[model samples]
Target: MHLKDIIWMGGLLTVLSFPVSATEIEWPVYGGDNLHQRHSKLTQITKNNVSGLVEAWEFDTGINATFQATPVVQDGVMYVSLPFNDVVALDAASGKQLWRYEHDLDEDYPICCGPANRGVAVSNGMVFTGTIDARLIALDAKTGEKRWDNRVVGDNTGIREEVSRLDDSELGSVSGTSGAGINMAPMIYQDTVIIGITGVGYGLHLDATDSDSPLGAVVGIAGKYGRRGFMAGYDMKTGKQKWQFDTIKSKNWEGDFVTKTADGVELPRDIAKERASLEKYSDAWRYGGASAWSTPVIDPYTGILHFGTGNPSPQMEGSSRPGDNLYSSSLLALDANSGDYRWHYQQVPHDSWGYDVASPPVLFEITIKGKPIPAIGQAGKTGWFYVHDRRNGKFLYKSEAFVPQKNMFELPTSEGTIIYPGVMGGANWSPVSVDARRRLVFIAAIHWPVEYKLHQQPARNGEAAIRYSSMSPLNTPEKHGLLTAIDLDNGEIVWQVKTENPLIGGVLSTASGLVFTGEGRGELMAFDADSGEKRWSGKTEAGVNAPPITYSINGKQHIAVAVGGNRLFGFKTGQKIKVWRLP
Candidate 1:
């Protein structure tokens, strides 16, 4: 049977087993459903009537930070997390506030990125959120009262001490140093809440001087600074630890020192030099930075969970940490119940370009040679849409470049090298939308190029010599966005639409033949899913740098999104959740 038929039968079985109200459709999961499709089946608002959409209601969160949460709805109640990890439950039909939970963060902890919480997960009358201070808390879904709070990690003073010992010049143009925290929405499977850590990858972020401009740069310094990252599951009832899977393996973390990607793309590596120095950094896995940047998507039938990992420590200068860096920059599969490793596919071996598998993976079925194969797709920062067999993590194929590509996988030089789809990505941590029946995947991508320059400083004042690299996106008029549709069957670009600013958030597609996405320029847009034609645009008070979600209440369709701008990209930040519907 086709994947669409499987999905339809699954929904039918769900409805037969548990009677659901026909008038109410809830977006219960972060990515619409367990498959992480981000595609809605609602069709009340069609292409012809989409232009008639107007603001139905709006609720201000009273927080002005990088708001990136994708709101979740269930049983006529909407749950969303603010940039500071505070969560509020709102009435789905009206904008009335039901209750709020104020997250108490530790003021002394070092935060790698600015205050940004992707969202919350609701299950079994409990609302779960990962805080900026690296703690996971569960709140009573109805009363917003805290039930339990579990600290994921201890004080990160060791990382801070290592960073402090580095020379000032070796740190490069830095706005912030690396630290540990949680940024992704928690994923619940059965009785476990799964989440991962971020900012463990040693790098320095440069903030834009102008509050309305994009980021300044991302610098990678060579040193032993960050701790290993991991994803762990916790008991739902008591918040007790269940199982943990470290992104960097404890044994043989270096692997076979392959000179190319698993899919056969050659990389620029000094294998001889790395092999000779393996013993020098044999214990690098302790500080090997493979931060988990996004949430995991599971296959219910097989009990396998798939997710992405971030870059290795010391970021772009990989001299100290050699070899393939094991699980960093790779797609990982694990047994959902036990956290046992199943398989992995590294996209960048011995990576030094900051190409992290930061986007969430989408699961579906594809027919190959008349046999239905479980497939997974991830929108990569390296300007490609990669497809793989979900069951065993086998690379199937990669789509045509969705954005411009130049000097890819090239080593940095003192004179600097220009690369497209730089650190900000062809796709960042944004979730993608998939239309299974249409065999198309929608992507919201960025088209910014960066000048990759290497810096070397000699020893001074009894300090050791240091080397690092700085990646600065060219502040040119050409930086923009691309909303692309790629054919899943053949891995081809079906259509693309360009925007004035680089896309930062995500995309949402509906069965009504409409695609929705937000822009950094304060506009939410809809397009013809088949042709990529703009159908409607609505102005917002702040940058709509978050994914748009659609659902129905009382048989009436509505669209909603978080309207706070991203601070790292320097968009206009605000504190509002806007809902719209056709009039």
Candidate 2:
């Protein structure tokens, strides 16, 4: 096998030179491996036998909340994180609980979205998880006992006060106020466990009036409301800070004011006005919001970490922050060892449309123009799967819009501008799966259109007038979901499937030529990877609003996923991890 076929399992480089037995197959990372491919090599559950899969076991976390964890398995133990950041060790074969570590959150700790932890990272006999209170914790892999706890950030006084002062009436009916927290699964690179902070790109998320409906709106009030976000590395054993990379650049944030994207998509910008007001908000980067929304994929050969950044702060209204936001709404590459900036590809410059590059990036080798190149792909909220040269961040090509996109990059007007793949995203924090051998990328995406409206309120209570913007899904279009497979070689949709509701979680691809993903209606469905044929479907008690992972224990293959629904999208919430296998 070639060097490109080597897989990094929990920071150790292992070459896939020969076929390993099914018993040795285990999901050791959030995306199945360090490449974040989310592909399993075990073939016991082939397409022919997938329809016969039956429930093998189910484990309830007992804390019903928005569960989005992707369980990691190694040896015979499955390590999973709960909605409240609690860690649990389970017997992978029977879903039997071995040990549990309850996370003790600070009573006054600030939370943005509900307690939704993506998952945990296990390395060197320790399980690492980032808490909703901005703390990094390490637990013994054997007994689930605490090893070390490090606070990623100490001061949240400013953000807490700002959130407290937010007027609900002015912001509409919000479900939660944005505050700093850590929700992403930590990534282990060598001896350092990497994680990032979220909610720094503060925006008030409105709640849907109907309990079963999707989100209502995301309101962005114009002011200094958030602090800069960062992704840092810490020692896995001691939880000591190694280095930090700020998402927003303090200086030279205003890049070349390009009127269009690299692909020639025109942007609506007041370049003249922005240049004139540049000096006024000169210190804007201090509070600039570009929250790290997902786990990064590292190029083991190059030692470069690739990840995405969220929308700029004060969210939708960007008048106060001038020029192209350097790092926000972009794909960034940094040195994994030193945390030094390598390159960045900004998808939306000075973005006011809330088009965050929120999806976790996937790395693979692609042949471009007869030359094999190390490439990285990120499914963007802008509705395009962006492919770039992973080594130097070169724009290669982007897949056709998987979801319907109308009036993209349009600035909000007082009357309201309608846009598909709005704040909720074309591909939110969901991770994509890649079948390197087939050159296909599977993505779970949303097709909900939202109305972007600008609001200007009159001066009241001795305060000055306030201007803001809001995004809410439009009822007329009717929200839905799309599971798309894009050919990496040609950047075209190979196959696509539609679902009744928006797909929020992630995707799993298997060597059995099967693709698995969940729906908001609580069904785990599998599809033929080559053709968009629905092969099988399994119903769950709650919405399967998390990624599915496949592993083999005792030579028996099993598929598992966290079954708690997402609160932001108003999916039916529960507390269960369901596993299935061919009986």
User: How far is each candidate from the true structure, as Cα RMSD in Å?
Assistant: 3.8, 4.5
lDDT (Cα atoms) of all candidates against the true structure: 0.86, 0.86
Best by lDDT: 1
Model 1 residue 305 CA deviation (Å) reads 0.7
Estimate, for each residue in 39-115, the C-alpha lDDT of model 2 and write its tens digit: 88778998898999999999989988888999999888999999878999999999899999998888686666568
RMSD of 2: 4.5
Worst 10 residues of 1 by lDDT: 15-24
Over 345-385, each residue of candidate 1 has an lDDT whose tens digit, in order, gives: 98887778889998899998889999999999999999899
- Taking all chains together, each candidate's TM-score versus the true structure is 0.94, 0.94
